[model samples]
Target: MDTTMGASRRRGRLAAVATVVTAAAFTTALTGCGSVDKTLDCVQTADTIADSVTDLQQAVEDAAHDPGRADAALDSIETQLRRIGDKTDSTDVNQAVDDLDRAVGRVRTALRNGDRTPDVGPVTDAAGELTKVCTT
Candidate 1:
């Protein structure tokens, strides 16, 4: 009887410890690096990318003589897109990154054409598309 009681006590203690540990882990998962924070980061990154695209367009318009301005804007957009990709953790975000990449490519091509009145139509369209993707 004593042996049986001791075994029961050990089992009870083990079960309690397991329950506590599980609860702690669950709480940590819920509170640390949860979806809410990730979503906020996504929103912020998307906004940054949109703003960068706008800045790039403006720079292209105003500083056509300074290719460095275009380079800086592209760099900013690339960094923001990379951050969004890194933090996305979802298929939607992945698609958004892909879309942004295509948009950036379009913009680069438009800028490189070197026509004084080059068809900015494609660059503008791409930027608009990227903005929509980011917002979504």
Candidate 2:
């Protein structure tokens, strides 16, 4: 009777340990998944920004014929930036987004000042930085 009671206590201890390990592993996986999800969101938003940048380039070229196109492209890029900002808490990502936002603001300022072909090089450069940060 003593041997049986001791064995049952050992089994219970082992069961508790196993449950703890399983819970720890599950929690670790969930933490990893959060990071992966954040990365995916950043990358997708960066891609969308890239497309908007391309549109901005084209719009700048056609600005004399259709001034509204440039504004539309700028708006789209801002929207994507906002989406990314809302989703990420990473410092690098937030910095990149801020840089991009400033570049966009510069371009918008130039446009409002009546510069039809405002330099979009900064915008492109900032966007490239954003993409790089998102991937890393």
Candidate 3:
């Protein structure tokens, strides 16, 4: 009877350990999925930002016809940047955001100073860097 009890107790303990291991594995898988989701969000936002940057370039090129379109493009880029920024706490990602933000600021400053054809090269460069970091 004592041997029987011992065997039953061992089986119970093994089941408990197995349950814990399974729960741990499930939790870990969930955490990994969450991380992948975040990365996809970031990459998608960066792609949108790239589009906005391209729009900004075109807007500047056609500034003689639509002087206000650049502002709209900048707004779009800023919104996307905020979305990506909110989704991450990575130093590299934040730095990329700051760089792009500064580039946008420079363009605005140029506009304020009566430079409608502000150079958008920096904006493009920063946006490319942002996309690269996001994919990584």
Candidate 4:
């Protein structure tokens, strides 16, 4: 009976060690693929910026017919850009956000003055640059 009990204790210890080793291996494997998380984050951020730009573009187009709606859209775009700028650590992304912010500011000014013909080229160009950085 003592011999059987000793063998059972050895088996239990071995199983515990195996469990610990497996857990460590799994953790290492996940840590090794940490870059996957970073890549996903970049893609998501890029998509968000792209969507904001699209919204801004649509708002600009609608401005000729509804300046009030366009002004509201511009405000939303500015808020989104500020959030993106605050969250991003990349210099390129920051610069792109800054460029977009400036372009949006210009549009807002034009809208305030009832220009109804604000240039959108700069905003489009800045958004494209931001997308490039996110994709690559």
Candidate 5:
């Protein structure tokens, strides 16, 4: 009877230890998952910004050739910048996006009015700034 009691107590202790270790491992795994998710979000945001910049560059070229294309490009750029701002947690990125959006709106308005002499310098500067922010 004494031997049986000792064995039973030992089993209980082993089980308790196992449960503790398992819980710890599970918690650690969850923490790691959170980190991975954050990293993925950042990568996705960067890709979005990169794609927007590429498209905007092409649009600028197209606008130079065909003013009519500027409206669509401006709309696309505004939408993309908004999305990028929404997804990112960075304040600098959000501010940059907002600045670019405003500049794009100005360019769009000028283009719509058939202004052949629309100043593109602001838009160009904003885009350059955004590109630099994204690349870093």
Candidate 6:
């Protein structure tokens, strides 16, 4: 009788350990899947923002010539970037958005000062850096 009780207790402990291990494995898998989704969203947002940067640069050139469209394209870019930042929950995205804002200021200055083109290198570099840091 004592031997049977000992065997039963051992089986119960083994079953309990198996259940805990299975639960832990499933929790890990779920957490990993969540991270994958977040990374995908970050990548998509980065690509969208990069494309918008191109549009904004072209729009700035047009605004320089027309003046009437001065803030229109820039405002659109700002709105899109805000949405991206909201989705990603990334401080890098926020910093890049602010950098782009400053770059827009530079473009406005260049336009008012009768310069043909604004210096956009800093803005490009900042965007690239932010995308790199945030996507990972």
Task: State the C-alpha lDDT per candidate.
Answer: 0.57, 0.78, 0.75, 0.60, 0.56, 0.56
What is the C-alpha lDDT profile of model 4 across 26-57, one tens digit per residue? 44446545554443454455455555555555
Tens-digit per-residue lDDT, 1-136, candidate 2: 4745644554454344334434444444465676767776677677778778878877887799999999999999999999999999989999999999999999999999999988777787787777777766
Collision pairs in model 4: none
- TM-score (C-alpha, index-matched) for candidate 4: 0.63
| Candidate 3 structure quality by residue, lDDT tens digits, 12-45 | 5434433443444444445567766776677667
Task: State which candidate, 5 or 6, has the greater TM-score.
Answer: 6
Tens-place lDDT digits, model 6, residues 1-136: 4745644554454344334434444444455677656655555555555555555555555654666454554565566567666776667666776776677667667767866555544545555654555444
| Over 4 Å off, model 6 | 1-32, 61-70, 109-116
Please give the lDDT score for candidate 2: 0.78
lDDT winner between candidates 3 and 6: 3
TM-score of each: 0.60, 0.76, 0.75, 0.63, 0.53, 0.55
Give the candidates in order of lDDT, highest first: 2, 3, 4, 1, 6, 5
Residue 3 C-alpha lDDT in model 5? 44
**How does residue 7 of candidate 6 score in lDDT?**
42
Better of 4 and 5 by lDDT: 4
Model 4 Cα RMSD, 1 decimal: 22.9
**TM-score of predicted structure 3:** 0.75
Over 4 Å off, model 4: 1-39
Which portions of model 5 miss their true places by more than 4 Å?
1-65
lDDT (C-alpha) at residue 100 in model 6: 65
- Tell me the lDDT of candidate 1: 0.57
Over 4 Å off, model 1: 1-33, 115-136
Task: Judge candidate 5 against the unseen true structure and give its global Cα lDDT, from 0 to 1.
Answer: 0.56
RMSD of 6: 23.4
What number of backbone clashes does candidate 4 have, counting pairs of residues 3 or more apart or in separate chains? Answer: 0
Q: Name the TM-score of candidate 2.
A: 0.76
Q: How does residue 89 of candidate 5 score in lDDT?
A: 75
Superposed model 2: Cα runs more than 4 Å off: 1-32
Sliding window of 10 residues with minimal summed lDDT for model 2:
13-22
Clash list (residue pairs), candidate 6:
none
